[model samples]
Target: MNSRKQVASSFTSATQIPISKEILETPVVTTIVSSSDEEEEMSFEADLWVSLTKTGKQKTPNMIRNDLQKYIDECKENGTSSQAKIVKSLAVDNDSFRKFMNPKNYPDQWSATKNETYWAATKLLEKVKHEKKSTKVATVSSARSKRKTSDSPCISQKKTKSELRSDLKALIARVHAVPNVAQNGGVYDSCTEVVAKIKKFLNRDGMTKALFLEAVLGGVNPHILAKFLAGKKQDQCETIVYRTAYVFFEKLRILEGRKKSKARNINEERYPQGFSLTKK
Candidate 1:
């Protein structure tokens, strides 16, 4: 009997366990629910607070929240964000202003101006104006100084006649001393004597020695005698003295070649015939 009783108790316990498992796995329709209870609780709390505030004559948090949102939307529509407005207002054609607009390139606190955009434009314009003015002033001053130097009388003054005559005599003496001239059968000596005689003759003709030397040196070719007369008639005695020296040197070279036993190739062909005594 006791064994039957124990068997019956075991069967009852096993059946009860399975029934409890089925009930947990497949809940009853009345026991199951959607998960919106927390949301509904929050909404009820918000409504209750709004009603209490209205009765107490206090502003509702939702009203304040909506107003603040409306204000933000209006500001965005009007392009009124501080940084955005500044960038727009400071819009300029200048490269510097463009660089300044780049946050990574520009300093955070550039100046005390409340509007950074307008400040940059004004500052750059002023700087460019000042630079142009400075450049103009510098150019004008440089031109004025250059003109002054060019027009100065001292810069254009020529050597005096006496100084020129002295220089010519010295040059002739140097030419005579050259070894080539000495070997040319005293041809250079004759040239020097001719020049001296011409100077004397001109002096006798009431021409100052300085004026005579100047005309000769200025391309008269005193050695030709005819050119010398022409130069004197033309009042170009300085040119005569100058051109005569060239002819004298050329003749000296020819004479030197004749004196050389081997007939030295002096290459006088390189010199233009009459050009040797012509003015530059």
Candidate 2:
């Protein structure tokens, strides 16, 4: 036994012997690292000119009218007959005048020539207003033609409390069916087929309000999942689904928080070496 122990110790020492520094040292090899050098050439040139041409067109009636009117008014004050010449030159004919007055026909002029045209048209409209004011006219009261509350029999109609309660109960029952259908991802498909069948049933019944409500609430139509779910009572269904989904989401959030807390506690207790959670 002592001899066997001696042989084992010798084997262990031989295997565990440290490597020499010379054997561990790696040879240095000269390696040429090559990279291409590139340069971007850039050039810029600018040219400019000045001229006496007008920057924008003077096409607006308001602008033309204002300038024309100002010139005419100045001529009038100076006791010159140039007003008649300007009017003759600028005044559109009755046919063209009507078209020009239309905003659609003269969009640019309408917008840009507002101030100028307003003054010009004001003068013209004053003449028209004066003419109209001079003429006598009869007036009629529109209130006499309006219908009174007493004329309509249905205006005072009210729904009964029993009717409202019945509607609510029916809607609740319909909502309960949604969860069963929605379970196992079959709700959308079931609702679609149901809606289509319901539509056909309603159409056969001549599209009455009762039929519409029944079809929508019962999910008795044959349509796409989106369309099937989109019922008259969809708002109510959405409310229920939203509440349920929100509850689920809240529970999930709480579970996640708990898991994180537990993980953090475990990490704090262990503090294992070389087991860092922080990214390098």
Candidate 3:
């Protein structure tokens, strides 16, 4: 039994491969960084971009306009006055304040109703606020909701710090169980498949709030584990898994060792992609 334990310990030690500086310094995946339910997991901003890119040239301005209009109308109908959410959803370009404000882009700049929404969104977003963000951040809200702010319909909400740690602890455990990133590709391939599946699901069904919070909070979506860590810091162990989790929606594909582009421009994304855990 002692020998067996020794063997297991050796195996575990062997698996703890040194992470290359190249890996951590790898060029971040580029993304238009930007939430969920069982019927509605992943982020709406990420989902929107997914649908748009998939449609390709086939997606006309009118189609985008209609979609934007529908989203705006729905928010107002639901009495949701979350300017932050609305702004984030509409403005995807990291630097362009008017990315979604133009008539050529999507929203009708001439119309009062749409223009109101557009200006409000822009005013809420501080310039350079997204500078530090990266590609992995495009999808997902925070793991926990803020106390029912004035905008929140709920009367109040709370979660102890212990609960947050417990949840993160479980998620890190699952990430470790996945193939090690230090070995070959890690969970990058699996990550891609899951993200594609999520994009397809959202595009096919369109938007539905009936199950949004549940998916965002993880009643049905496994991606929430990744989602929760979006745009957040990571420790040593969590960093390993963050690399794989980030692969799901990263736009920046280059790493530090790769050839850097001369004409390449960098933009800040809202969500985080890479992850790591500090403790054993």
Candidate 4:
């Protein structure tokens, strides 16, 4: 019995969810901030669970459920359930529909993400239900209109770093905007500058993927990801994200050490216990 009142494993409660497609695609175990300044993730237990579970295997664990999934194990008495099951049921659960859709009725501390999750679950169900017949005119046109900039050549509109950091896609745009001077004789930004900027903008969660993506790969270039991030069997997206972050933070350890050393040096010149070192 989930004390929160176990929701039915359905997706009816979700509607008009406002989350972005990019956030939906990211792996849930994503690092937000480094301990010293950055960090790594996607725990083995979660991976193992995904390997063993049959539900929602289509999407990466990095999305939303990782935060909401652990209760499933505790919920064993209710029988094995995945976030997918929960959202699928919520989609149509009339009680949830009320709580998620109406702001005035929102449960205490309940973010609108609940609605977003349901919407994702609903779309997922629809996709699973209709796996065939991809040749549709209107659908194709509609999709083209919504095409992600990351899927192709970068088309950047100028935005402040603050604006870019506020949203992942906006940050992606910043990462994508590494103008190639050789090709277009545009302004060239060194990789170091970009990495520094990314590290500065991210929060202290030590879980953000933006820092590592830029530090190792120059940026989360979707074009490059096709060549290096995917393998024949499992996707290496989460692997690279953590691997690079690990290395990035390991280097930061040196910075942390230096900071301590500087403090020690200042302390080394301490005044005599009872008397001042400086002449009166």
- For TM-score, candidate 1 versus 3, the one ahead is 3
Task: Output the TM-score of candidate 3.
Answer: 0.28
Q: RMSDs, each prediction?
A: 47.2, 36.8, 21.6, 21.4
Better of 2 and 4 by lDDT: 4
- Over 4 Å off, model 1: 1-156, 182-224, 227-247, 251-280
The number of the candidate with the highest TM-score is 3
lDDT of 4 by residue, 185-266 (tens): 2111112222333344354334255544564445766444444333321233233332343234333434344332221222
Residue by residue across 1-280, what tens digits does model 2's lDDT show?
2322342234334334475533222111121111110110000000000001142221234444444456557768878656455444434344543443455654333332222333234334333333454342211222332343347656655457566556645643454444322222212111222333333334431344343444333433333333434543223233223233223222333443433222223323444331221222
Best by lDDT: 1
Off by over 4 Å in 4: 1-83, 86-212, 223-243, 257-280
**Candidate 1 residues 1-280, lDDT tens each?**
2322342234334444546543332222211111222222111111011111322322222333333335436658777654344334435344543444344552322211122332333322333444566679979998997787788856654567777667656555554555543221211212222443454345432345444445434433335454444342123333434345544554434544534211111112222221222232
Q: What is the C-alpha lDDT of each candidate?
A: 0.37, 0.33, 0.34, 0.35
Clashes of each: 22, 11, 31, 33
Which regions of candidate 2 fall more than 4 Å away from where they truly are?
1-53, 56-59, 90-280
Candidate 1 global lDDT: 0.37
